[model samples]
Target: MQRVKPGDGRALKRFRWWQSLSRALFHLRLMDGDSGQTVYSVDVRHQQHSSSSGRVVAHLYLDGRHHAESTVPAVFPVQGGTVEVRASTVGLKRCHYVTAEGAEFQLVPDPASAEGRRARLDRSHPALSRCMGFLSGTVLVVGVVLLALQLAEQITRDPEGVAQYAGTLTSPIDLSGWANTVVGLCTVAASTERALRLRYNWLLDGAAG
Candidate 1:
């Protein structure tokens, strides 16, 4: 990244709740270009949420100082590489700093954030993290299957020529209204939990969301 002098890293903005579960802050540390003794800091924020107005921005800092800012799908020039920040409908799916030499590393998460907590859990308890990951995936798979079956029923219920060829189909498992609501809620929770760990499967979590 271009070193923009010492004092530029001022007026750092505090985090906002609009960040939702999809927001994440990461830090990259590197040495300065001019003076080898100086250290530069890069901070990137990825925020994705349904509540947002569709604007995404990433901020860069030098020595804990604000240096520059750019919108998501952003690229920040750094010492030997660039930091790329990206987001998806539910959360960040990509946030990494890539070097000119092709080596890459993810930024460090802020200790206070939910993403940070999830990262900590992964580091401290790999087994538990794996179990939770598997559970989330299984939940999403169930949701996908149910949704597909329901859609199939809806498609075949109306008397149509296609139904004659395809054969009438009805969902074997029917859920009451309240049960449907509960399933919806559980699907949302499962997707959110998966997002916390930056785990996303387009067919599973995408459909669940």
Candidate 2:
């Protein structure tokens, strides 16, 4: 555990390796209500339990002080906005702090986390990051297309009236079971990487999930 500052009331969270696949950390800063010049920080960690049905916890901090906490979907009232957090099996799908004026901003990860490292990479090497992002989107799109074709073939193979109207369908990229397993794993990795960047397309990424 790390403190936001020396003698600060709240314990700043440090990312752990074991939670790499199941945890997300985010931070937000705002003007303090009590002090005009002092700024406050809201730190939140979305940690999911190991079980499939386990719940996720969102811890909120204010000005390095423990302010409030809740489980998804969490809503914490703060200066000029409300901090909201949401989670999924893969990690956080939403962690935006929305202002009263309708402006929205996402809380980024702490500098020590894996997500933070990736964000730093984007800042330092934008072209590479963009390429990786595009690659992830492409992978998800391919997965979605393959899944749709397979589903269509499966549906048309046995159905009578539908098959008669649409004709029997066949997937163009048929592969062995081992090949499919490799593709599935690659798709999952792509989706997870996109999730780290907070980039998601419902049609493409959802199908991968």
Candidate 3:
């Protein structure tokens, strides 16, 4: 096998090539490349097989930032072909792709060897769930307060009898606004929790490096 130095480009351009291949999986990483920042990196994952109908795709990476991904489909007529990619930017460009080379390929997800991303997310923190509960409770409070205010307003509207409930008027929360706020808060909390879990897992797996 031979290596080639395919130098710098833009942020989303691909910069490497696999001239020919058959039945395999591969990984590519750019340790440092791009014009925006020297801290950027990239990783590409390609999986192909004899049974695969198309070429294995090499997901793109710019200065470590994930911008685009596409699979190279396996072609018919039973023949070999080239796979290529590029780097977008400049600075110590390491253009390399890793391939899983072996015979008797078997498709399977290794459990013991598999990284437990899902389980880790769930076991992350009680704070996330509790924050969700808090947003739900806010909805209840908003409803109760709005209902009480509406009732008082209705009672005071009676013409004949004197309206006894006299209090300073000021709306605490709008119904629609409260609902939207609650929903948004919950969504943000959930997303944040997920992001935190993912980052933590990556760090654990040494992928953050």
Highest-scoring model, lDDT: 2
| Best by the TM-score measure | 2
lDDT of 1 by residue, 76-148 (tens): 7777878776655566656677999999787776665677788999999999999998887887788899899
Of candidate 2, the 10-residue stretch with the lowest lDDT total is 1-10
For model 3 the local lDDT of residue 86 reads 27
Overall local distance difference test of candidate 2: 0.71
Predicted structure 2, TM vs. truth: 0.82
Candidate 2's C-alpha runs over 4 A off are 1-12, 36-54, 64-66
TM-score of each: 0.76, 0.82, 0.23
- For TM-score, candidate 1 versus 3, the one ahead is 1
lDDT of 1 at 121: 94
Task: Please give the distance, in angstroms, between residue 79's alpha carbon in candidate 1 and its true position after superposition.
Answer: 2.9
> What is candidate 3's TM-score against the reference?
0.23
| Full-model lDDT for every candidate | 0.70, 0.71, 0.32
- Model 1 reaches what TM-score against the true structure? 0.76
